[model samples]
Target chain A: MPDLFVGVDVGGTSVKCALSGPDGKVFHEGSIPTESHEGPEAVLKRIGDYVTFLTNDIGGRPAALGMGLPGLVDAHKGISRYLPNMTTHWRDVPAAAILGRQLGCEVRLLNDVRMATYGELIYGLGKPVNTMVFIAIGTGIGGGIVIDNKLRLGPLGAAGELGHQTIDPTGPLCGCGNHGCLETLASGTALAAEGIRLMLVGMAPALHDAVDGDPGKVTVEVMGAVAEQDEPVKQAIQHAAFYIAIGVANVVVAIHPELVVIGGGVAKLGDLLLGPIRHDVRARVGRLFPVDDIRIENSQLGSKAGVLGAIALAIHGLPA
Target chain B: MPDLFVGVDVGGTSVKCALSGPDGKVFHEGSIPTESHEGPEAVLKRIGDYVTFLTNDIGGRPAALGMGLPGLVDAHKGISRYLPNMTTHWRDVPAAAILGRQLGCEVRLLNDVRMATYGELIYGLGKPVNTMVFIAIGTGIGGGIVIDNKLRLGPLGAAGELGHQTIDPTGPLCGCGNHGCLETLASGTALAAEGIRLMLVGMAPALHDAVDGDPGKVTVEVMGAVAEQDEPVKQAIQHAAFYIAIGVANVVVAIHPELVVIGGGVAKLGDLLLGPIRHDVRARVGRLFPVDDIRIENSQLGSKAGVLGAIALAIHGLPA
Candidate 1:
């Protein structure tokens, strides 16, 4: 039997696991409730048990396991530095060592978004490009950078925090404690905040109707659904795209990537958001570099990018 | 006799050249007026002539020549895409091939700032770092990025335009056609502009006295000289530092380099400007990553960085 690579993507709500062959063909997939509140030990052990059961059911021996964890990851040390959203913040947890011991296989770790970027690099749009930037615009904005056909995990293993870039110095304070970060101006959270604000002000009648006037229900989907008929919804998305474009332009000028792939929940809005970002990025960076040649497009892998990236990690080992 | 490598740094006004050994030791250096009005053909021919004369003087054959050209460069194709500062804009000129043909040696080309970064990486503070960002804050802001110990010249050979990153979305229009670029906020030109504004408004009496009340004479030096006694001059420096810090912070989060070296004329202010930038960058990025570990310092090479960087490039050839 061929050795199977196991990839695990741990999210705030659930843990996704996939078993794949050396050729990257997925053989089995499953998800389990994160129950992160039970703490890192229990969650990791459960993941170990699930993977063991998966390999046993497939009658395959596990060669290596790769896991994508959210938040600040010290990939070098196989430790989770700080996972802001996870219970107990997953601070200082030697996740890779623990998982490797439990599964009796070598375990590699990376930030979830970077894992997705690796997936994109190995299997998606970024596969053909030498240099690329992958930005995931969900509740917050996160990013991963690939240069010279290898993922760049800076000295601290915490590079590519694209959303934390300050777009407006005097803009609102960000959750990251910086004032006017790109996340504060854009991101799904920013859009939802704007949607809620518009709904509260009675400016977005369509949005109000779509969410039954519940601000808590306001999401990127609700905003997109109401955007065609709602001036305020369209304006909110344009506003987010305007700031997002600045962020993208900033990264483009900084790194000059040949391709920029946008992924995550918010990116599902597609051309409505990407069009303005594309137009604005061209206008901003056109004079400095050949902006026309830089391809900015949406990610097709969606949530699966993380698991696939983990598989790539398992197959390729750590990035140099 | 050991073959000598020739490195040339072409500027808007003057061209600096250096002959260095394979060990990166500069054997001799010379300079001549750019007289860019002579156009690309004449300027390159003169450069070839100067290399020939220099080689004859040293009794050494030219093994390879590396040049750092101002403005857009296609290092891969050895073409100058658009040298905006040059008289002809140096559009689509085959610089490397022309120089190689004249000198009977291989020629490598890179953007001036990137060459300086290469120099810093191999011969200066960046020598010890695997990942680095070198920002030269002069008449304009420019930068170079080194990833995995190699200079990253994007597909367009224009990866590091650090000064062009937008810090303010609604700030004044920049020469690059973008609004509120870091250059517009913190470059030598920006400080000079602020100094001139202060002088014209009679807010900078010390600056007025230093430049003999001439607005055209206002420079980063004049501002620094009066910064101690002039509140407005101090304010202007602080303001520029504020924005420069943002640019630094933005790059830090984007690439997470182990070192960020500041070069060019404006960096001469040293701690006065660097201090504030350091403080603000720490404050802004402290929450996102380990800011304390990232070293931000002034460039030691200063004016010779470009020439030295060219020398390093000549010795090392093109980055992979």
Candidate 2:
């Protein structure tokens, strides 16, 4: 029988796990509510339980396990250095050690975006590319960079912070404490904020009506839905796209990645987000590069990216 | 006897060549006017003649010859795709073929910035680091990225066109035909233009006096000299530094290089250019990175970087 690997994506609200065969095909998948409020240890217990349940259903123990966490992870030491929404007490948690002990196998930990990029490179759209930049524009922006087909996890593992790039020097401060970060200008939260601001200004009447006059209810999805008919919403999306393009163009000029893959919530808006970005990139990139040759693509793996990427990490860590 | 190599830096006005031992020490160097107006063939002849002159000066023909050109270069095919300063007929010229036949040795061709980057990595400040970004802020800005200790020459051999990055979507058009490029705002030409503008507006009285009322005489050096006493010139330099910081900060977030080395004519102003850039970069980088950890330093090799880098290229291309 072929050995299997278990991949887990630990998120703020849920724990998504998948069982994959040696070739990286997901044979079984499951998710469980992350009862983080119960405590960090309890959350770890729940994740272990989910992993066991999946393994039992598959009728065997996996060869190894891999996990992706949404935070600062010390992958080499197998520690969760800092993770938001995973409980305050979770800081400096020896996550991989505990998980490895629970599952009776070695486990590897990695940043969520890095894992996702690895998955994409090995199994998704990045299959044949040597260099790529992956951007996840959700409530906040996150990114991973691949150069020469290897994930670029800098010495501090803080490399590929694309969202933190300052696009507007005088713009608002970002949660990361920087002013005018691309995330502050182009992420899902930025679009929602733009929507709320427009609604408050009485400019997005359609969006205002969609949320039933509640300005606070303006979300990126709501904005995306009403974007076609509402000029304000469309403009907001366009505005976000422009700043995002600046960030992307900056990367293009600096790294010259063959492909740029964008994922996460805002990417669901499809061409609405990508169109303006592509236009701005082409116009900005101009003739300096074979700008036309660079492709701005959407992630194919979607929500499963994190979990599958964890699997890729497991496969990568396997002793040859 | 130690083996020697000849390195050439082909430029618009003159061709610079140097002879160096395998250790990369320069033993002999010379220059010859390109006289490009005589046409592309004449320019190529001049380069070959210079190479022969340098080899003769060293009393021996080098083992290999390496050349760094100013534009799109097909390093693999040894073709000069498109060089800005060279004549229009120079496009698609078999640079390596013609030069190799004339010099009676193996030849290699690379973009000027790429060769310079390799030179720095092996023989200069980049010796200890694995990842770095090299920027040459001259009449125009050009850059080279070294990731995992290898230069990233994108597929088209145009990966590090840092000057062309658009900082403002609606700003002035660049020589590259893009709008608001960092080059448009921060290059030496931009500084001179800013000085001239300040002179025209009567905002820089010192600069006006320095240039004798001829705005065209306002060069980057003149601007640097007048910058301290002239508020307008000082502001112009500050403005350029701010935009340059944006470009550098953007690279910082995207590539996370261990160091950034600045070279070129503007860099000669030393702290005058680097100080503001460092301050802006630190302020912009903020918490995402240990802002203090990333160092922005000056190029130690300076003008000879081009020739030395070409020599490094010859050594790099040498077979085991």
lDDT of 2 by residue, A181-258 (tens): 898889888889889988888888899889997967878888989998889889999999989998888888887888
Worst 10 residues of 1 chain A by lDDT: A82-91
Residue-wise lDDT of candidate 2 within B169-237, one digit each (tens)? 678888666888888888888888888888898899999989899977889898888888898788888
* Model 1 agreement with the true structure over B1-320: per-residue lDDT tens digits: 66999889998889999998888899798999999998999999999999999998889989989899988899999999988887767899999999999999999999999988988888789878888999999888899998888888888679999999988887889887888888888889888998899889989888888989988888898789889989999999999999999999999998898899999999999999999989999999998778888999999788788899888878877876
Q: Pick the candidate with the highest DockQ.
A: 1
Positional deviation of residue A156's Cα in model 1 after best superposition, in angstroms: 3.2
Candidate 1: misplaced stretches above 4 Å?
none
TM-score of chain B of 1: 0.97
Candidate 2 whole-model C-alpha lDDT, 0 to 1: 0.82
Top TM-score hit:
1
Best by lDDT: 1
Residue B41 deviation, candidate 1, in Å?
3.0
Model 2 segments beyond 4 Å from truth? A1-4, A35-41, A56-59, A84-93, A101-104, A318-320, B1-4, B85-90, B318-320
